[model samples]
Target: MKKFGILVVVFIVCVAFLSSYANADVETEKISLNGSTSMEKMVNALKEGLEDKYPELLIEPQFTGSSAGIEAVLNGTTDIGNSSRYLKDSEKEKGLIENIVAIDAIVIVTDTQNKVNNLTTQQLIDIYTGKIRNWKEVGGEDLPIVVVGREAGSGTRSAFEEILHIEEQCQYANEVNETGPIIAKVQSIHGAIGYVSLDVIDETVKPLAIDGIQASEETIQNGQYSLQRPFVMATKDTIEKQNEEVQKLFQYIQSEDGQKIIRAVGLVPTSNKMSY
Candidate 1:
């Protein structure tokens, strides 16, 4: 009877140890990613691909704006920070490394009913800076041009304004907080014109040609399209210094399989031999 009791106690201890080890393993498999609403589709696609490839791995993503995402990674709260624009000098000073995984075009969009099909670089600058207030000024109808834009700190907004040299000069009638709402607002309004990531554009809104160059993989890759920006997955430290799961995520992003996923989502992968 004494021997049996001792054997039962040993068995219980072994089971408890195994359970704790299993829980720890599961926790280690999770990789947290936060940032860039613009990169949401690409990140989600990569998340699904990674999970499918390594069933034990889990990718947790949060679609806070790009600046917030950078702050999260800087504060050690996330494994990756997705930014549609390149990191600023101030951000780079804080030890964050910019990893350009893909190039994204910031396409200007308007309502489907709008007659305007293109805008010269100067015309785009004039329109956004409040110089051209009527769509008729740019060969559209006589309706008042409603400027739709992303809120402050958005990567898409930052890139759009910077590329046009109209930062802080935009006469925005409606400032939305996310990319989806910009698309929705532009779709619903007759004179609404906005900019969004090229990957996110759908039939809901019509994309405009900038300076006679349509936003496409070829135009953006060849420098013909000037409204493009880098899709950055930022890290506080080098990939070699990150944890196993974080390292694996970055590795997969650079792999051929990952490049396919990037292209599949309408983003131009860095592997396309284009200089960033």
Candidate 2:
């Protein structure tokens, strides 16, 4: 009887130890990604897909613009920052690590009612800076142009201005907080014009050709669209140096399946050949 009691107690202890080990091994990983409004739908989809595969993982995403996201990662506020532009040397000097996740064509959009079908980069710069106020000046109906833009910290805004050399001179008539807001405004206000990721364009807005090239998926992929920019996943040392879970999350993002998800969100996928 004494032997049997001891054996039972040992069995219970072994079972408890095994269960504890299993729980520890199956612990959930949580990550926080912050950045571009342009990548919101894609990031959300990533969260959903990752969750479905690894129910133990949790992903929290925040949209504060690409610059803000990169800053957040540098400041240790987020595990990853979503950027529509590459990280600058200054950013890298600050210990910001970048992972190029995808490519996106900065699409020029106008109110659906507007008849303007295309614009040259120079023409876009001219129209936005209040230099060319009338649509007829650019082959459209005679109407005053209403320029809408993203806030200064936006990656989309940064890339657009960078390409046009208007980072300092382009004057915006209105600055919106998010891509959705900009899209909605452009769709409703006749003569209103703005730019956003191609995924965000809908029937309510008309996409304008750039340099006679339409900002379509094929054109963007073929590099005919000059406004194509890389989407970056960035992290500070917290993720790069110390967090195992962050490493795992980033690994999933850089995986082939992840690139497919990025493409499905209406952005171009960057080949590993490009520098991050």
Against the reference, the lDDT scores of all candidates come to 0.91, 0.82
Q: What's the true lDDT of residue 185 in model 1?
A: 96
Candidate 2 lDDT, 88-134, residue by residue in tens: 99998898766676778888999888877889888988987778999
Off by over 4 Å in 2: 1-26, 237-242, 271-276
**Ten contiguous residues minimizing lDDT sum, candidate 2:** 267-276
- Residue 275 Cα positional deviation in candidate 1, in Å, after optimal superposition: 14
What TM-score, over all chains together, does every model reach?
A: 0.89, 0.85
Model 1, range 37-73, lDDT digits (tens) per residue?
A: 9999999999999999888898999999999999999
Residue 212 displacement in candidate 2 (angstroms): 1.2
Alpha carbon deviation, residue 6, candidate 2 (Å): 30
Location of the lowest summed lDDT over 10 successive residues in candidate 1: 267-276
